[model samples]
Target: MTDIGIVGAGAAAAAATYVIDGALPDASITVFEKSGGLCGRAATRRRGDVTYDYGANYLKDDDDRVVDLVSTFDDGLVEVAGDIHVFDRSGTVSEGRDADERKWTYRTGLTRLAKHLFGATDATVHRRTRVERIARSDGAWTLTDDDGGTRGPFDVLLLNPPAPQTATLLETADWDAAARDDLLAATRDVDYRTVWTAVLGYPFELDRPYYALVNTDKEHDVGWVAREECKPGHVPDGESVLVVQANHEWSVERYDADPARNVADLADHAAALLDDERLADPAWTDHQGWRYALPESGLRRGARTPAEDAGCYVLGDWVAGEARLHAAVRNGLDTGERIVHAR
Candidate 1:
């Protein structure tokens, strides 16, 4: 039995495993996650009666692969076709017919999609287990956790961690010095930006439309605003929920700042956008900082292989050109297919 080890239980890892399970039905798979939960960047938080998508809010179904994968999950996903308001830096709003472009979201929460991918299988998932190092010995690979203990003799290993972190992991592996340098150079040239997501719940409703894509090049810090209540199954009746995404530059600047203050500032800025004073005070608020929210530069596809020469592969949105959940899932599926076929 070939043992395939996958890192990061996010959409990419889950999707990859889902694809691999179909291709290689008897192959053993294991997923390692630094957090207790499976969702990597697709995390969600429930505040009161409202469930907020703290990570990826919505997915654009522009590619056929994404649409096909979404169709597999019947009740797990819902399509939204409504008025989408796009605001430029000058505060000028534009509403177009493209608003009908399909936007898919999880019914209960984004994490539901992850759980669905981890369906009945012998795949071992180690949560809250941080991989300290990945090395090779006697033609087999070994993965070590923070405690210096190792899990090894794997047939394949997948490095799905963030790009920056992937470089570090390769350094600790037994790759040729030249290969290590090349991997470092590849990752060093790659850049990533941060984003601060502020999830707020208000007692009163804001007059703004359900989905507002804002491009404020001035004092405002938010780039996109999604009214959580507008999405089905997210909010209860009469309750208002909002998700504000801060611009990359602004999020990076205040990445380590106070969470409460970040949430308050986001709420205040959103209120200014709607010119409504009621939004100035929200009933419940939470903030999450994502240091690697989006990839700054595109990575060369097929440029990377397993650093330890093991069947382990690397997959994620960062390698797939976009940071959206759909892209992550597609990337995972593609990676899994490639691995299974190669075997």
Candidate 2:
């Protein structure tokens, strides 16, 4: 059996695994994920009766291939109900260029997208298993977790973490130094925009024409505010949930600040932007800080050759040259096809 190992069980990794499983049904696939959840930044959380997606927002149906892939799942898949409005740095809201593009998320949450993809595969996913080291030996790859547990000598290895985390793994990999160095440098070239997210819940309802309001000008402290209730089956009747994301500068500044303070501050920003004082005092709140939230740039394609030749593949939004969920899935599909072709 061809042994395949994957690091990070994100959307891209799940897609790749799905494709690989379909093509090579007997391939033994193993995955290591550092977090408790399957999807990385395409995260979803539920508290009581409220479900919200606080990171990466909705998955846009931009790529036909990704659209076709997700449609096949068909379970719990949902369309975000309203259009996206825009706001200025001064907090003036207006009608945005409501493009006809379809925006999607699962009724359960965006995380269900990854769950559906991975669920269809035969791959074994190890959640909360942090891989600390990678080594190449005897024409195979091996991984050691933080707990000192070792997994395989796999024939192929796929990395799906953010560029920085992937680079860290490459930095100390016991492989051909030159090849590893080249791949490491390429991974390092990717830069990210941090995001501080606050999920605000209220006991009442929020009636708005648009599902979300985005800052057209990047100068605003808050970057995006989305209503979770816009997605069906997410928020229960008469209860509103808002996912507020702070801009890169503001996120970087207060990333380590007190969580309560940061949540209150973002709630204040939301209150001003929405022109509702009641929003400033959310009945309940949750927060998350994404240090490598969005990639500002993609990795250079040529930099991947040496590593791929060594039986290692990298797939993610950064490698796909776009920071969208669809891009990540598309990249995963293409990468899986490439691996199948190589085999």
Candidate 3:
């Protein structure tokens, strides 16, 4: 049986896991995730009875394969039906950028996308298991966790971390120096944009024609403000939840600042943009800081050459050169197929 080891249980990793498991049913696939959650930045959270996707608002219906995958497996799938308004740096809101196609989400949130893909496979996923060291011996790969525990000489190893983090691993890995240098250099060339998000909950309803407000000019401190109430089961009746994401500049500036202050500032920006004073102070708030949230550029062509030669593969949205969730899934699918064919 083929033995596969993967690090970081993101969307691409989950997609790869599903495809690999299906192709080789008897294969033993093991996954290590540093965090307790799956799907990486396509994150979700629950506060009492409320559930919201604070990271990625919704998946676009642009890709047929992703659309088919979600529709086929996610029974709780729900489409977001309202238009998205544009908010400028001047705090003016206008409606002209409504999406042509539907925005899809689920009752349980975006994390369900990963869960569905992984649930179908027999792969064993270990959460909160941080793999700190990577080593190779006799043409086989092994991983060492933070607790000094080692994972194994597997036939194949897949890396699903962001480009920068993946570069760090390659730098410290006890593998071929020339191959590692090539991969690390290529990975270092991949750029990323950070994002700081704030989730605000209000007891009263927000009477807005649009479900979200995005900054078209890219000059605003607040990049996006989306309403969770637009999703079917995200918010309760008569209550509204707004997810406010700061722009790249704002996020980088205050990434190391206090959480409470950042949340308040985002709420203030939202209040001015939405023309509602009530949004300035939410009843309750949740916050997340994504240091390497979105990839600005894709990996270089030669980057994967070295890894592939070493019986190692790296796949993610960044590798696919797109920050979208669909791209990550597609990358994983293609990577899985490549691994299967190579075997």
Q: Where does candidate 2 clash, by residue pair?
A: none
Instruction: Name the runs in model 1 displaced over 4 angstroms.
Output: 216-220, 305-310
Every candidate's lDDT: 0.76, 0.92, 0.91
Model 1: per-residue Cα lDDT over 164-226, one tens digit each? 888788877765555456656776567887889988788765555546555645345788777
TM-score of each: 0.93, 0.98, 0.98
Regarding TM-score, does 2 or 3 come out ahead?
2
lDDT tens digits by residue: candidate 2, 1-343: 8999999999999999999999997799999999999888999999987889988899998888998998899798999999999999899999996567789998889999889988898889999999999999989999999999899989999999999999999988888757788889989999999999999999999989999999989999999999999999999999999999999999999999999999999999999999999999999999999999999999887888888888899999999778889899999999999888888
User: In lDDT terms, how accurate is model 3?
Assistant: 0.91
* Most TM-score-accurate candidate: 2
Q: Candidate 3: which pairs clash?
A: none
Name the lDDT value of residue 336 in candidate 1: 84
Residue 169 error for model 2, in Å? 0.3
